[model samples]
Target: MASPIKSYVPYSIFLIALLLRPSSLTTAADFSSSVCSGTLDPSRCFQVIKTIPGGGQAPSLESLCGTAISFSLSKGNQFHSYVQSLAASASNPKLKQVYSSCAENYDDFIGNLQSAQVMLKRQDYNGVSTMASSSMTEVDTCSDSFKEGSVADPSQLIDKNKYYYTLSLIILRISNKLGGAA
Candidate 1:
């Protein structure tokens, strides 16, 4: 038979390990809930973070925001390519013009997003917010082109456009929160 002291050895080690773990060690759900609490759409913010592997487990707001920014950048690149294809495939001159214009907007948006990544790396939260806001403006410009007198986007980029705006808005809000955290 095992002695009582020996039987408790493993449990004691477990308890000590738990105690020594840093307070910063947090579950993904907890991280997402706290990060999304003050965002424009907390549900969407949480969902976005969940899409990113290990994003919700970020130890700091800055790192989580970095994940979000990278996600947005990936989407922006995809959207740019799609818009460029739309422009190439468009038969109507006006439609072609509109898509071409949107591609330009995406170019600007992507540039801004890249700058935001740089700012986040430098811990310049304000710069991140500025660039994110610029990105939102670029999306807005792309959207506005659709409304210009029955342009009639056959590709229905508008639906995709909304997500771009929301992602940028999330980045902006998160960066602002990071500013407060600083």
Candidate 2:
């Protein structure tokens, strides 16, 4: 017959091993899926972003706008400089307007992303999360607009944004499961 203490020791070791294992190890795939789905839903984006460490703070609309303004100015200046370099440039007013509008929107999006990155660096989880969610929403809108023919040739942008968003969401979920976030 086995001694009682020896019998319990194996069970105790097994329990400890089980407890020591990271929880996220099992649900990584699920989190990846959530991020993929969230690309189409801002709410989902919010949820996913909230799970990441340094990603769950609110953002100031004013700050976002200011960033947008600066981004737009820089973008506009660069485009103007590029246009000046064109030797035989004959600008179409309509095309120029469209391009400018697109550039502005792009700048705004980039600004939002930069702000979110800063928040993340500061360990402002909530702010980063909120901004990330908003960014996801913007991407979703861009995707839908492209699909609806409201935007032209958005495939490259969609693919690029989607890939990063999905990766972040998956990483967040895994981190959460790992007890990186409460």
Candidate 3:
């Protein structure tokens, strides 16, 4: 007959294994698929996130959002500066008006992104979503200023706006997955 302690040893080991198992173990590719599933352009979303600087390896959703937000903020500021420069240099009154309005709109866009970051820090996912969505809308409002055949369409701005919106959606999805935050 085996000793009582020895008889229980295997069971104890099994129990320990069960308790130590990770609750959610995911590879970078798996995380990408999960995050991109809700987006219109999942491939692009996956590609963008997978290629984040200092983030080739798997990253948690929070880190991914922070990286993407940093990029988006940089682009937003660049667009604003571009508009300001255009406004200052333009001889045409109409062009100056469009550029000035776009500069203001981009200013609001940067503010919205900043507010979204604050909300995310507070774990107020709904507030983050609202601010991010509002930021994207401001991009459209800026683009529309030139849409009456008054000025040429800025394709780069349009593309950047779409990309930022996708990032916002990813952030919203991640927040939602973290439970009831959104």
Candidate 4:
């Protein structure tokens, strides 16, 4: 027969290992599916979020918010650079003026996103929503510049801006939900 102490030692080690292992918690699929359920493009939302580095396992609401905020910052910076380049390259003074406005608009957009990120970290849902909404308006401001100028809209820029705006909206919505839950 096995000694009682030896039998207990194996069981104790097993219990210790189990206790030390991190909790399964939430998977990325679970989080993305739940988060994207109400969005217009659930699949696109899931794909965009899951593709972020370490985003495939969003263990908490904070993790999801972080990923969204990071993506928004990246997109905002890219848009700012693109508009700056457009302003620099435009030969027509009128077009150059509009592009310069766009560049400034993008600067405001990035500022809003940065504000939203800070609010998110502080768990200030109302502030996050306000900042994100403001960022969306910045995109509209840029688009309207072309409309008011009676020039063709920059389709590519508009599309990309919309995509980034949608991501910000998603983050805002999630933050609101978390606030309500709290």
Candidate 5:
């Protein structure tokens, strides 16, 4: 038989190759599904925002929240920058208000997410669930209020609400996955 070192060389090389392989080999479609709740298949990014949780699906809320949190973390500064861009670019006072309100809510969502994460890490399952549920309700209320309000142009508001809703869903999903109530 060959020497022990020679015999192990192939196995070691294979292991090294596996470790060095890239993990982000997903397609745009796959990325969309993971971020946008499988509604991004048609290239309609906004469609992902319109999905509502139903059918007694407990995981829906959690999924939305988790996705939102991920999005915020990945684009927190960029989101703020966009808000500033809107504020500078929009001439309508109502539009400015809409953008400002959305920005504020985005900040609030991020804060709430941080708090929820702490609660989860502390093993405060009840607290985590309670916070997630309350936050989700707030997101719904904000979305409805913006729709009904005389914001003139509500697209920005709607987009912000969608982001918040997604985040709330993600938070709920993670909490439930950690054995907390959805």
Candidate 6:
């Protein structure tokens, strides 16, 4: 029979190689699909993620969550500023009122997102989800205000609101997947 030590040489090398390797190596596409899997609309989630700068290459699930919250915050701030400018410039009293209300809504939305950012830093995924849901409610309230006012929709304002709501849903769903704190 072959010597026992010689028989085990190849097995030992193989085990060593396995131990040295990373736990799992997944491609960016794999990461995207997995990260987007549990969302309300996986397809939309993937598309939205891809639209964010460097989003497609998120190295891990937590990083993906960060990307979503950070992008939403940035977009919320931009929308808030836009609404404020609209509120200032709108000549029609009804339009001005709608814009002013939207500005306030955006303010609350931004606050929720800011809170979500903190929760994300703390790895409190549930807390982040709650904040995202609250942010979505703000958007919904703003949309409802528009419908109630019957003001002519400003160029892209309504569409942006709808899009942000969808983004908020994405954030909430993704955060839910992580469960509670790490």
Model number with the top lDDT: 1
Task: Order the candidate numbers by TM-score, best to worst.
Answer: 6, 1, 4, 3, 5, 2
lDDT of 2 at 87: 15
| lDDT for position 165 in model 5 | 60
List ranges where model 3 is wrong by over 4 Å.
Answer: 1-24, 154-156, 179-182
TM-score, structure 2 vs. true: 0.42
lDDT sort, best first: 1, 6, 4, 3, 5, 2
Give candidate 5 regions above 4 Å deviation.
Answer: 1-71, 134-138, 152-160, 180-182
TM-score for each model: 0.78, 0.42, 0.72, 0.75, 0.51, 0.79
Model 1 misplaced stretches (Cα beyond 4 Å): 1-27
lDDT of each residue in 46-164, candidate 4, tens digit only: 76676567667667767777777788788779878988998898877877888899899889988988888888888887888788778878878887788787765443666666666
RMSDs, each prediction?
Answer: 6.8, 10.7, 4.0, 6.5, 10.9, 4.0
- CA deviation > 4 Å runs, candidate 6: 1-23, 35-42, 180-182
Per residue, candidate 5 scores C-alpha lDDT tens digits across 28-111 of 334334444533233344354334323123244344444444554445446656666775677787667666665665566556
Q: What lDDT does model 2 reach?
A: 0.45
Scored against the true structure, residue 160 in model 5 reaches a CA lDDT of: 67
Query: Model 4 residue 156 lDDT?
Result: 60
Per-residue lDDT for 5 in model 3?
100
- Model 4 whole-model lDDT (C-alpha atoms): 0.76
lDDT per residue (tens digit) for residues 1-182 in model 2 = 98999989989999999999855353433443433453456565544444433322213222332333344335434543443332124255443443444344445555555675566456565665565455545545544544554445422544544633543343333223233343
> In terms of TM-score, how similar is model 4 to the real structure?
0.75
What digit string (tens of lDDT, one per residue) describes model 6 on residues 1-182?
A: 89999999999999999999966676667766766677677887777768767667777667877887899889889989999999999999998999999999999999998999899999898899999999999999888887899888865688778778877877776687678422
